[model samples]
Target chain A: MGTVSTVLSPPALRTGMALAGAGFRRWATYRQAMLAGAFTNTVFGFLRTSVMLAVAAGAGGVAAGYRGPQLATYVWVGQGLLAVVQLWGWTELSDRVRTGDVQSDLLRPVHPVLSYLAADLGRAAFALCSRFVLPMVVGLIAFDLYLPHRPATYPLFLLSMLFATVVSFGVRYLVNLTAFWLLDIRGVIMAWLLCSNALTGMYFPIAFLPGWAQAVLWYATPFPSILQAPVDVVVERGTAGHQATVLAVQGCWAAVMLAAAVVVQRRAERRLVVQGG
Target chain B: MADRPTTAAAYRALLGAQLRAQTQYRFSFALDTAASALITLLDVVSVLVLFRVTPALAGFSFTDSLLIAGLANAAFQLCDMCVGNIDTMREYIRTGRFDAVLLRPLRVLPQLVFGDFSPRRIGRAAQALVVLVVALSLADVTWTPARTVLVVIAPLSGAVIFGAVFVAGSTTAFWFVESGEFANAFTYGGRDFTIYPVGIYPGWFRAVFAYSLGFAFVAYFPGLALLGRPDPLGTPGFLPWCSPLVAVLAATAAALVWRVGVRHYRSTGS
Candidate 1:
């Protein structure tokens, strides 16, 4: 206990780094799953890019303010980012809660949230290298995938991706926390899957929605901070200030959701009733 | 395998037990159903969003694509409701469940695919049906009696084809335990591919997903028949009416693959 360090302290940072490395190693073993996921993403990439190109053909080479290159970048890179941000079902936390394995998580010196975040970051790093690159390679041969115009946009996009990962973790942790009171979290997870895919632009750009709908999604929900904002960052969607503002919004959502998670965990601690020995 | 009546009764019994267990959490079930419906409805909205940017996709009008999308959606969801759990073959194998299943006096395919139902999928299927009904009403089809029969036959045929895809794809799990995403690329990815006119895709893509696989028969060809139009990609005149034949062939292939898979199953000796 004397050696234990608070969040961001040296020892805690070391622990987080180790956890992240472990996470990276853990997922790296799933070689076939990686190949399968990449194949699926690339297939869907062709489906999406083809349709968007058709739309471009119909609109005389520009549709919804995106040219062919922009559409290619959006569809392909966004498909890669799908696994990076993990915009769908993940139930490990809730499973731990149900099985009472979370008690072991609590007994650790490092905080559960911090550890999980670190591990997820590791997972994202692995995905960014493997799953993320595969679709880009496939898309490059087939379509005009876009690259950032300014050198500065690259680092900004990286920061946005990091923020997106944090925001996703925060939102998912809160969703998982619902298991504290619910008999089953499957509905919650399904509902999350359905809405997040739509709102986060997994199916199509939130930008392609009616302007009012886009604004509502952009401002009112943290969903876009997960996938849409990061992609927008890379595509150089607007002026530098607009990109900065998008990054800022992502940062804000990440902070807000994480704060909410901390608060919820505090509350759940009060109702701590382990289910099984 | 059990007697026909007994197998049918077993399916009913298993499905009933599953429904009871799921409905025991009434609130979650309702929430999930609504979410499921809304999720699928968003797929329709996604197409509308595409049309908002363009008047036509590869010469198919908004309503024409809608029929294609709706038909594919309805068929995929029906198959998803029935055979979707074939994606869980890895788990059944890994847990020694396949071994137990083999010992049972029940037909493997029905026990595996048809013995469970998730009510949430009903919401998705129902929403797709609504889309199909809407697309049918809105599309500029000249309603011949033959076309009318196509309306009834097409979706059922498409569903059979998709179910076959699910079975065929998941049979790979017999070799690769973690083949979920591989199977999903065809079952789910095929749904996305079929929703638009085949002309929108590139030549190689069309050759692979549409001609090589049976996805074209799911919606594009049937859609052509419904609209009384030729394929924009120059599919033959007789192709539109070939969905039934395609469905039978796909089903036959799937049955063979599943048989070989079951024969090769060496379950976890847990």
Candidate 2:
């Protein structure tokens, strides 16, 4: 709070933006990879949509508190958000940590956490335009999506999405930071990947789970905040107050995760040996 | 042709070496096995979660659906254990490792696949097998001798089908370095597609993925055969028993594709 006034000074802002742009450019160069990702997402979108819609139809046009259109929104939006949130397949930090490139990163003027977050934000931005857009259009054409009835839901959903990205990056950063201590982080990474995909609303809606389980997942675990909360916001899962509450929870997780990531990174930096000449 | 026996022996030795090396790291193998078991557990939980929302999915009840899910998953895991490393073809090509691979005496596909083979990966298939057994006991299907025979044959046929799909999908790596995600659209995507009732999908999707691509034969038809039930979508009655035939056809196509891919490899020459 004390440094808020100078936080956005031109130099700092420029550095953040430059790193973000570099991140965007680096990812954008893999155009075919992006296309393949979108294609895969769209395919899964169709499969999930069909299954969820069948559930909805089975339950007499509503399944797990979601109507047909809402289910469509959930599945398609989930497919798009899957790439933007990047539930798995990120190991850049850990790779750098392995090769001792992280020492150079620490030598830079900018904080490592902040700089990496900026780059991730840029990657998310590029994904938003590329892989994300395709699923949105495909969902619109293939299914009846629930376009947010309330005007305020739009911005709130966007905010929740941005926060989801932060929460995801924070978790990812902490997971990668394990490489400093565990040279072979494969087990840790595998555990993270399994949990994120299985529990994080990637395969199916958590709402379909039993009430106790859903409550535990939404409130106790960060997985729902990373995915389910934002989709809930878009589909207007609850009243205005409830939407606000979900967003607030997601925001809190974002901040907590970021702070935790920074602390772990600091500890890791002190212990980093940078072995080999 | 006369040297086939030696080639087979050499391949077994290579795969044995890989398995031995992997088991040397007991902790990592154990963690992977635990994670694999956990993943299978979650697969059941996800399906149960879906059932909590509705009584049935496209005319299949919870137990009925589990039969499909278990068979599909067990078969998929078996295939993954066998030829999943074929996906590393892109990296091998990019890192100029394929040049050395080409210099080898044995065939390319078998070498690439068996080179990293790990039998411990059967951990996942074992978990899926548990689910299949549970589904058998709980589900309302009347067990007959024919049904028992079908159960024994289905998962093996399904593995063959899935293995073919994997090889066919990875074949694209010969031309496109970034073909991994595209291959996943069929490989992993097919697993996700098969775990649910195929009748739930739309007609066109079922035609392309379930029938044309042979994903349905992995579990759907075999499941129907086991249950002695006809498909809700009303295909021919004998479709359920045709999975072995489909598996053969798909494997043949995959082998042909692999040959074409190996021929197309001009080598990075770096």
lDDT of 1 by residue, B83-194 (tens): 8777777678767788877887887877876555676777777878988999999999999999999988998899999999988888787898776487788888898898
Kindly report the interface RMSD of candidate 1, rounded to 1 decimal: 1.1
TM-score of chain A of 2: 0.96
Candidate 1 lDDT over A113-201, as tens digits, reads 88899999999999999999998898888787888999999999899989999999998999898887774787898889987888897
Q: DockQ, per-model, please? A: 0.78, 0.66
Give one digit per residue, the lDDT tens place, for model 2 in B102-167.
999877888888887767566767877888899888878888888888888889889999999888
Q: Could you say which candidate leads in DockQ?
A: 1
Would candidate 1 be rated incorrect, acceptable, medium or high by CAPRI criteria? Answer: medium
Cα misplacement distance, residue A144 of candidate 1 (Å): 1.4
Give lDDT per model, in order: 0.86, 0.87
Instruction: Name the runs in model 2 displaced over 4 angstroms.
Output: A1-7, B1-29
Error of 1 at A232 (Å): 0.8
- Scoring only the second chain, what is candidate 2's TM-score? 0.92
Candidate 2 CAPRI grade: medium
